[model samples]
Target: MYSSLTEIFKILGIVSIGSFSIVGLCAFLFKKLFDYYLKEELARTQSNLQLKNEKLKIEIESTKQNKILAFKTLHEERALLIKDLYSKLYLLKVEYEKIKLQETSLSFEQLNSIEKECIEIQKVVGLNRLYLTKSISENLNELIKKFERTNEILKDLFSIGENTFSSMSEVSNYKPDQEEIEILHEKLISLISDIIELLDKLEESFKLLLNIE
Candidate 1:
């Protein structure tokens, strides 16, 4: 009976060790599986983040291009309006000079007729000048407001052109010296020239923004 009990205890000891070993192996396998699943999840999350970042970058670039195109179009339209204003002013100046010359040369009856013509011309010219001036001022004001908004967008979207137009408009409004007025036709001409150049620069900037050759 003593030998049989010893044998039974030995068998039990081996069985217990084997059972513990099997449980330990199972636990290790489960831990490895969990670690593998966590790694896969991390990689997927990183990939999604990268894709989102790329999409944001694309949207930012598209917005910048749109702003540049809009500015270029506005600049072009403003320049054309300025040119028209200058041309009208030039015509008025020419008409005034002719009337002045006629006044100096004519006789009583002829001068009277000439005077009537001059008065009629003055009336028409005055009306036209008033209309042109008002239109130009309104258009300029509108352009300035748009330019201010465009400037803000440019700064936020990308580092781009400075707001030179607003400064130019201010300078154009400054009262001119008599000598300056005589030397130059008028302030309108100078303003138009500046606008033309600015429009050219704007066009180039738009081309670059769009990556168009």
Candidate 2:
């Protein structure tokens, strides 16, 4: 009976050691699997962050390019406006000088020719004024309206001159007074000066719009 008991005790000790080893192996495997899963999750999160960062950089670049394009467009438009304004002013000056010259040489045919040229100049100036007023910024609308009103007054004055020239062409006895001609010339000069001042202001406004000031 003593011998049997010893053998059973030895068997039980071996079984306990085997169970402990199995449990330890299972715990080690579980730890390794948990660590591997955590590493995969961290890697995915890092990749997502990198993609978002790259997307933001691309968006920033696109916005910068759009801003540059917009500024370039504005600059080009301002240049065109300046060119048109200068041309109109020059043409108006030439027309005024022609009218002044007509006073010295009093020929009906010459007056008619000068009147035709003046009409053409007025047409061009009118078109330019329309464009200028249309293209002006909202901030300058009041100033633009003032200039437009002045342009309308000039247009009326030119129309009166045209009618007077027509009447003079038809009637040979009609002669304009020297003093009246001189006064009209002075008024024309004053109007031209006002237009030039407005154009200078418009240029300054454009510069401000471009943030160049």
Candidate 3:
């Protein structure tokens, strides 16, 4: 009986040691697998992040290119608009010089048309303001203000001259008060010069904004 019990205890001890070994080995393998999977997932996430960053950079560059293209398109249209404005100013200046230098006059209809054109110009200038640089915008606005002032002066001058002429009983004759005419001529000339200066500054600002001449 004693020998039999010793044999039984030895068998149980071997079985217990074998089971512990198996459990330990399984736990070690599981740990290795979990570590490998964790590393793989981290690497994949990093790669995806890098790809997204590159895509964002490309999109930003594309947007900047689009803005430059839009600016170029608007620049061409603005150039033509400025030219038209200058022509109108020149016409007004020439007519005023005629009246100032000699006893000459533009018909009421012609003067009225010019006044209407000035109003139209005031409306159009606001549209161009979006495309202009800060310096150009300010300078252009200055010129526009001067133009409006000149238009106001022209209206007053014509009203006075026309009323004076009508009172003289001569519809075809043109005459102006010598002192008032001299003062107006000097003011008009100065205003014209100021407008021209502002125009030049605006052109310079445009070229600088465009990186041109």
lDDT of 3: 0.68
Every model's TM-score: 0.48, 0.61, 0.65
lDDT of 3 by residue, 153-202 (tens): 65565553545555433433545466756767787787667666756765
The lDDT for every candidate, in the order shown, is 0.50, 0.60, 0.68
TM-score between candidate 1 and the true structure: 0.48
Q: How much does each candidate deviate from the true structure in C-alpha RMSD?
A: 18.5, 5.9, 4.6
Candidate 1 local lDDT, 12-77, one digit each (tens): 999999999999999999999999999999999999999999999999999999998897776565
By lDDT, the best candidate is 3
lDDT of 2 by residue, 148-179 (tens): 45444434434334455566444444445667
Which model is ahead, 1 or 3, in terms of TM-score? 3
Q: Candidate 2 regions off by >4 Å? A: 2-9, 97-174, 205-213
Poorest stretch of ten by lDDT in candidate 2: 135-144
